[model samples]
Target: MGRNTRKRRSPLATKVIAGAAALAVGGGGLVWANFYASAHESGPSHNRTRSAGAQVATIQCPDVGQKLRKVPRGARAGVDRELAQLDKQITEAYARLASTRQAQSGDASYVQNAILGPLKSKRTAALDRIGTNIRRVGGNTPQGLGRFAECRGMGVDQPDDGNGNAGNGQDGQNGDGQGEDDGQGQNGGQGQDGGQNQGDNGNGAAGPFAEDFVDINDVQPGSRDLENGFAANGEGGSQGSFTAVCGVNENNLFNSDNLIVAPGVDNGAHHTHDYVGNQDNDAFSSDEDLANAETSCQNQGDRSTYYWPVLRLQDGTQEFDAGDLGGGAEGNVGKILKASEAEIKFVGNQRSDVVAMPKFLRIITGDAKAFTNGVANANSSFSCTGFEDRQVTDKYVLCPEGSQVVRTSNFQSCWDGQNIDSANHRDHVAFVQQDGSCPNGFQAIPQLQVRLVYDVPAPTVENGQVQNPYAVDGFPEQLHKPITDHNDFINVMDENLMNEVVDCINSGEDCQ
Candidate 1:
């Protein structure tokens, strides 16, 4: 009992001392926390007060309406920084999109023309090479003897093949198709000169091999006479000199030695002998052939058929006014498909070379007026199906017929206040009559037929090489500007761009 009393009395003091030490330590820690909190929340006194350690610790239950500081001393910045980064990304995206759109929808002809122009020149070069090769081989065909005969007819001396002998009319061997001559004297066997043994083939007639008898080394330099000409071969017979028999096929073929007559009729000189029934060998054989020729010729004429515009005269009928002249002059008769290189040649017997160097040929006196009209006004407008109607100003209307003027009143404005509707804004032309009859040096006509001539870029050269030799054939004439090239040609066709082509043509650079 005495021990229990002694401990109980003293234990209270021990408990009190322990409690005081604990309170002292807790109060000191609280004061340190408050001091740190006050220093951190020093931006402005208007801000809400902070707890002792809540400022640097987790705040599970923050006071209502208290705005938390967005960033701590070392925390990452907020929305503005992120927004800036996002804006940068957005700008980059837009730029990329713009570039992509341009690449996708930009000029097609210009892009294609860059590559195709050189190819066009190469095509001509290939044709020239073919001609050269034909000339080299002599006859229209690759057969050496045929080519030799052809060359001879053209006054081109053919050099003997390397074997030191003029090529025999029959592949080095004689007409008998034999090998080299044997040592059987003048009148040898198959390989021998059979004509020599046959009474010298009557009156010393020159045999087929006679011309070939010249030593190859003795032959002089030959000329390049291989043009696109054809000739026919003559018939063979038991009698007559072998040369005369085989020589029949010397100059009767068509198209650089194409067949035209029956064999043996007159050797090769059969221009008059109608072998295939149709004797007319001007250029084409039949109507179909003529059509093809005409098309090819036209294609070669402008490199772009778009230049030819149909002049529509208001007859209440949708016919093209090709040759409609107010005065009924052949020159002003119908709408002229603007003269193309081939057209110029076909109508005037002029070569493209005359016009190509200057990039244009002078308009014939008769055609000059019509050409001027076409250049001044040709309606070439088009539209897409789904999108707004696009008035195409980049192409021209080609009138296959003559130059006929259409009534100006007939040329109504398709544009009915709809700027984007192509059907409404397509190009239109009206022919104005003079004194309600005809104009100067002309006859009484109903209308003056005009066209919407598109602004097609003309072929050009830079540094002596073709810059845009042919654009319509391909696409996107060239690079630099969307509508113009360095040569000042309106390389693209569009409503706006068509004006450029018209302007250039009006200035006498591209059309006419």
Candidate 2:
């Protein structure tokens, strides 16, 4: 983990070093810093040899130290405008890069020429302009400008370390990936104590799943309570419902490119995921495939792919392992244990009037990038088997002896009823209202909730010392930290099953 003591060369410097031996000295005694040496120099009369070593040219960035001073009021607006333009340019550049794919030639020349090359050049130019504008507004610092340039010039598809820590090339200001400064407080910044027991309305005991334990109070109030079955006549007048169990598809368990987060980059997920049900589920899996793929579900027609980050447990020596499930490879940082059972339940909309979700509908719940942003976007909940009243939001829970640990995720259920997919992957669907009714323009559909139960053993203790506790894989360092785990589902249900589900909801029958 120690920093390398050798002097690090810039990318250009390395290239220069590789070609240094071929440069030639001019008649004026100045060495030409070119990759090729003139052939005429080989003539006997002109064969006077000169050392090929040339000092690497150091590109000097503008000195902006003095620019970080008092500025005129009018300059602020110009600076803001320029910064916004730069941000827009950077975002578009990333989008274009994401659309580029590898060719069959077994070479990445297309990616280099069409993506990374242009991206780096554009980013460098933007950073330079930004630096100049910041200085013009009297708000530039040498260190700040250097960091901005470095991060912006780095390639766009860099991966996170999976420990909630942003890797190099990430803008330090929004390294957590929320990418917006909406003034929401930092996660875990306010509450420190584990037993503070902050409750809904900021009073009384914490609700189930401990809504007060984090800042997710506004995410959707009933998610915790809804873990239990919804009442028959509770909201929008009870509708019919049925639960179909989609078993695990072991061969489909993958660590492929993730289109939701870092799109276009191959294997960008970094962490592995356990996928079930759908046979053709991947970053590039198409609507056509979803409609046709055979499924592992008993219904055979429900081909929806259910996926989540694999869970790993810490062993006796405090090292995390993935057990039998294949993960924690590449740059991933932990081990994992396979869930004994994974269940995907589809609950009919409380509104007895909603229709069926269209085929190939994509639904994403919870923010995968929410780990560092705090628990607001994290929709994960945990509880013990018998002591269900003690549901908590903490990453790792120490269950009592003879108890089982459970992780649950309930996805958004309301749909726009038009588009099967959206550019952002979320605009097509919305959450059901607090009163259990779908929003005006959105239609209510079956809600998908996944539950994984683990019979984790309590940490062994001897002589007042605690041994290994249960830990999930892929996070860096501390095995027990809370994670921003989320889930994604693309409805590949058979047309018949879909029709049946729609009928059940419209009929108000709660059948499992």
Per-model TM-score, in order, reads: 0.14, 0.53
**Alpha carbon RMSD to native, model 1:** 46.2
Highest TM-score scorer = 2
- The worst-scoring run of ten residues by lDDT in candidate 2 lies at 199-208
lDDT for each residue of candidate 2 in 15-59, tens digit (9 for 90 to 100): 211221211111110011221011112221212121221111111
**Residue 371, model 1, lDDT:** 12
Per-residue accuracy of model 1 over 1-512 as CA lDDT, tens digit each: 00000111223233211221111121110000110111112221211222121110100110100111122212112212222222222222212221221221233232123322333343334333433444443424122221211100000012233233442111222211122212211211211231112211110111111211111122222321111010011122011110000111122221111111111111111011111112222221322332232221112222211111122111112112111111010001111122121111110001111001111111101011111111222222221222112222221112122321111101211111212111101211112231121123322111111111222232222221221111111000011010110000001111332333334322324332
Clashes of each: 96, 14
**Cα lDDT over the full model 2:** 0.44
**Segments in model 1 whose C-alpha atoms lie over 4 Å from true places:** 1-118, 121-125, 133-283, 286-512
- The global C-alpha lDDT for each of the candidates, from Candidate 1 onward, is 0.17, 0.44
Displacement of residue 424 (Cα, Å) in model 1 is: 44
